[model samples]
Target: MSWPEGYGRLVLAQVDSTNAEAARRAPGLAGPEWILARAQSAARGRRGRAWAMPEGNFAATLVMRLDEPPEHRALRSFVAALALFDAVGALVGDDAGLALKWPNDVLLNGGKLAGILLESLGPHLAIGVGVNLIAAPGAGQVEPGALRPVSLLGETGVRVGPEAMLEALAGAYAAREAAFVTYGFGAIRTAWLARAMGIGAVATARTARDETTGTFETVDEAGHLVLKTAKGRVAIAAADVFF
Candidate 1:
C-alpha cells in the first residue's frame, strides 16, 4: 500500500537511538509526522533498558504533535502498537499468530516479536518501535515462550524490508487516527481488545507496591488494564503482566 503524502521524508541513519534522535529533531521539525530509522541501535525499552537492533531488525520512530492534552497521551502509544500490528500482519498474514500485549508489545505465536515505546518531547510525542524482521536478539530478552520471538522472515520465510514496513505502518496509523478522531477511543479500544493477548487469561501483575494475581479483563476507556481479582476489579495504570 502507498504511504500517506508528506510522511515519506524519513531520516535514515546507520546508528542512533530512534527515540532519542526523534525527540532531538522533533522541536525543530516543521512537519508533524516525520520518521527516523536506523540499522542498529544502542538503546532499548522502558526504564533505559538495552535493546539490540541488529542489521536485519527494524528500528524506527515517528514523531507526532497531537491536539489532545497530556492526560490522553497514552492513546498515541496504542495507535502506534496497532499500526505496527497491521504492518507486521500484512507482511506475515493475519493468521501468522500475531497478537498485541497491553501497553505496547507485539507477540507472535506467544513470543515477543516487536515493542513500542512512546516518549513525550514537549508538545510532540515520539513513538519508537522495534520489530524482529530477521532475528531476535538476546541482549534484551524479557521472557521465554514457545516461539522464542520469531521474526517475519523466520515465521513466513519471507524477507520483509524496513522501508516497506514503515510505509505500511504510516498508512495504518492514519486510519487509526481517523477512527480515533471521529468515534473517540472506543473504536481503537475494541480493535485492541480483539487482538489482546491476556484479555481472558489468568496473569500476574507486578506493580510498584504490590503484586496481584487475577484474570485479565478488558482495557478501560482511559487506557488502564482492568483486572478481575479475587477481591474485586482492579484498574491498573502501570504494571508488568506475566502468564
Candidate 2:
C-alpha cells in the first residue's frame, strides 16, 4: 500500500505505549506522524485501564498539533473512527459486518474489533488506536457484560500484519483529516452517523456516578451523544455505552 503523503511514520519492535512515544516526539514534529509498536508492554485504554497488545495486533498513535477549539479537536475521535471503518472494510472486502460504536469503538459481527483513545499531550493531541487483527483477549479478560473481543482473522479469516494495517489506516486517516479540515465537522458527523450502529434502539450509558437508559438518537453538532430518555432528551459528554 502507498503511504500517505506528508505524514511521518515510525515502526518499533516494542514500546511502553505508542501514545507515550508520541508525547515524547510531539514537540519536535513539523506535521502529523504515526508511531506503530509491534508490541506494547504497558499500553492503556481510557480511564487508565490496561490494554492488551498481543503479537500481530495493531497498536499505533497519530500525533499532531492543531490550532482549534477543544470541541473541534475532540471531533477527531469521529474522524479516526471513520478512517478505521474504511481501513477495516477494505481488508474484509465488504462492509457487511462492520459498524461504528459511539464514543470510540469498532464492531465486527457485533463484537469489539478495535478501540480508539485520544489524549492531549501539552501542545499536541495523540490518537491511539488498537486493533485485534490476529487474536482477541478471552471473555474473562474484559469487564462483565462487555462485548466479546474479536479478531479480524478469527472472524473473517483475514490475516494482516501490523505494518500493513498502519499503511491502510494512515492513508484512510489522511483523507478523513482533509475532509474535516476543509468542510468542518458537519460533513464528518453526517458520514459517521450513517455508519453508526444502534440508532433508534434502547441502550444504557453508564458514567462515573450514574447510568442512563434511553433510546439512541443522533449525535449532536458538538459530538455529544443524544438520547431520548423517559424523562427527556439528554446529551451526554462521555459514558460507557451498552446496547
Best by lDDT, which number?
2
Runs of candidate 2 with Cα error greater than 4 angstroms are none
Candidate whose TM-score is highest: 2
TM per candidate? 0.92, 0.98
Any residue pairs clashing in model 1, and if so which? none
lDDT of 1 by residue, 1-243 (tens): 887765635657765687777777787787756565656557668657677676767888888776668768878778778878888787766745888888788888777888888888888888888888888866336544322566777767879888777778788887887788789888899888888897788977776688888899889999988889989999888777787
Q: Give one digit per residue, the lDDT tens place, for model 2 in 1-243.
A: 589999999999989999999999999999989999999999998788888878899999999998777777899999999999999998779988999999999999999999999999877999999999999999888888889999999999989999889999999999999999899999999999999999999999998899999999999999999999989999999999999
